[model samples]
Target: MNERSLVFFVIVLLCAGFMALSSFEMVQDYIKPASGRSVILNHLMKLTVALVFFVVFLYTDHRMLFSRPVIVGGYVLSIALLVVVLILPGGETRTHRWMNLGYFSFQPSELVKIYTILFLAWYVEKNQLFMKRLFRGFLKPLLLVSPFLFLILVEPDFSTFALLFLTVMLTLYVAETRGVYVLTFFSIALIFFVYTYRMGMLNNILRSYQIERLVSYLKGNVSEQVMRAVEAIRSGGTVGKGMVLGEEKLFVPVVTSDFILAIVGEELGYIGLGVILFSFYGLVHSLVKVVSRMQPIPSVKTFISGFAILIMLQVMVNVGVVSGIFPVTGVTLPLVSYGGSSLLATMIGFGIVGNMILESERE
Candidate 1:
């Protein structure tokens, strides 16, 4: 690997370390309340999943994913998984979002996001010439991506769906697809939005909790969890209360998952927050530079760029929600959150970028 690639990898590690540190103290009950195993195991499991996926991606050729069979099957698998979640029993959670496979609970929506990136990248590359043709190239790609987005939205995972939509759109834009195609998608999206609002279809589709969250955001009314997070940042002042000393651990909701950044801010203070955010941007920046410098196929470049955009948007939304500027998106801080699905998806996504860099350097 090149020096720049190494730097980006190191920055990823630094961010991951901080995430682990912040999440180490989460109540064991959150994962498996009755397991009787040490709570530390939960965090370790997340780390293990992340590292395994990253290493696997580093060894794999990203180009193989574009094979006709893989693309077709992968897209079908994502749709099937999304549908299966709804079929399974939701029970107390009341959200049909996960597939309980005895030992591991799988969140298909998260993995599908990664798949969507690869699909779009491949599509853009394959159809670069056909983009000007509205039906064959432009509309086809949009039609293919719609199933993934629709399933996710119906899962009531509006946050993840929103981020996914933005990333795909950005990827299409970068892929040099016709501007009119992108504009058409946006126009249809706006019309759909207005129609849903007018017909009450949006409310019918979204879960009650989601509606409440959006309402709170629109009204400028902060939730108790956000208020506690604000207090944590406020009390930290310039320096901080010190690592592992953030008192917000007692009150803030899901400190290890959704609101991990708030703990970083409280424990590491503004300077630490700056460092974390800077590392995030730096990592994404490194991806951009590596992808740009590499003499790769257009799809590869677009894939890496789209992945970076997704991570950046997730970080912004997570921080914004915690800081009271945006609604609770349930989007985790890229490498700085404590969910296996999110962490695994992030590591694999970045690993593919590394793979591209390796190929470029080899050439």
Candidate 2:
């Protein structure tokens, strides 16, 4: 691989390693299997599936994959999967977001994130002139995104829905859509939020547990979960409790998924967390620099910058939620979360960004 490719690969490896370590802790804490073999097998299964997708993403031609028909077909497939998961029978926790396939359960909402990004990128790239049309220009993109957003919201995956909405808005803004149109959309979103709150529609839309989580945040009631997270960080102190010895892992649910950063903070301490954050910040900075340097290729530049912003935004929101600075939204820390679909989708997105950067360099 070239130097840039090497840098990308190193970053991916670092992320994957962090996630794998977190997953191991979760499995140990939660999954009490009859034998050590079974535990190892489960871990291997998850890691292998993620690795397979990572390889596929690394090899795939992102530009060709972003074509109109391909994008539409991907959206259709993602929605179909979501429907299938909703209809399938499983225990309450598993049934809500996953589809069982003998040995594994997959989350459709995870895949939907990638498909939505692909669709938005393709749409915005093709409609550069619409950026000047104000309200008329936004109609097409809005139409394309509306159904997807509705489906995701119905899935009760509001965190992913928020990410999708942010991605669309960012892509549109970067495409040079008028400020008034952007403001108009934000106004509409605010109005919708108020309507939902006043009508108790928000309560209907979110599950009781979800609503409680929101209430806990709004009321400034630090939940047991948040308290446990805080305790984890405190236990870590300056140097951390030293990996698997950390007590926080035993108390925190979904620590390997949504709140994995807390584990890092608990075991690796603030220094390790700071390193991870700095790496991500550096990645975002490099991406922005790449975009700015590509003045000769405005379309590609806009697309890359918008895409990078979407990724960074999700990261920030997820981190903020975990840190108790924002409402808990079920947003997983990108790259560092132990979900197969998320890992694959993120690799694919970064692959596309890398492709854009490479093309720019070639020019």
Best by lDDT: 1
Candidate with best TM-score: 1
lDDT of 1 by residue, 1-363 (tens): 344754665566446555545444543244434546443466577767777888888878877777889999998898999999878887563677888876667788888989999998888788778766777566787788998888888776888888888888777777776777888788888799778766767677788788778777878899998998788777777787776565565577887778776677777688777777777767777777777677858788878888878888887888888888998777887766767777778778877877777877787
lDDT of 2 by residue, 1-363 (tens): 233643664475456546546545554656443334343345456766665666666566666776778877887887788777667774664325777666766777776766666776677667666667855467677787687788777767777777888877877777777777878888999899878877878866877677778778878977776667778777787777665665566577777677777778777788777777776776677777777666444456655666677768878997787778888767776767666667666666666666665655666
Q: After superposition, how far is residue 314 of candidate 1 from its true place, in Å?
A: 0.7
RMSD of each: 3.2, 3.4
Q: Count the backbone clashes (under 3 Å) in each candidate.
A: 0, 0
Least accurate 10 contiguous residues by lDDT in model 1: 23-32
Candidate 1 Cα errors over 4 Å, as ranges: 1-39, 91-93
Q: After superposition, how far is residue 190 of candidate 1 from its true place, in Å?
A: 3.5
Per-residue lDDT value at 237 in model 2? 79
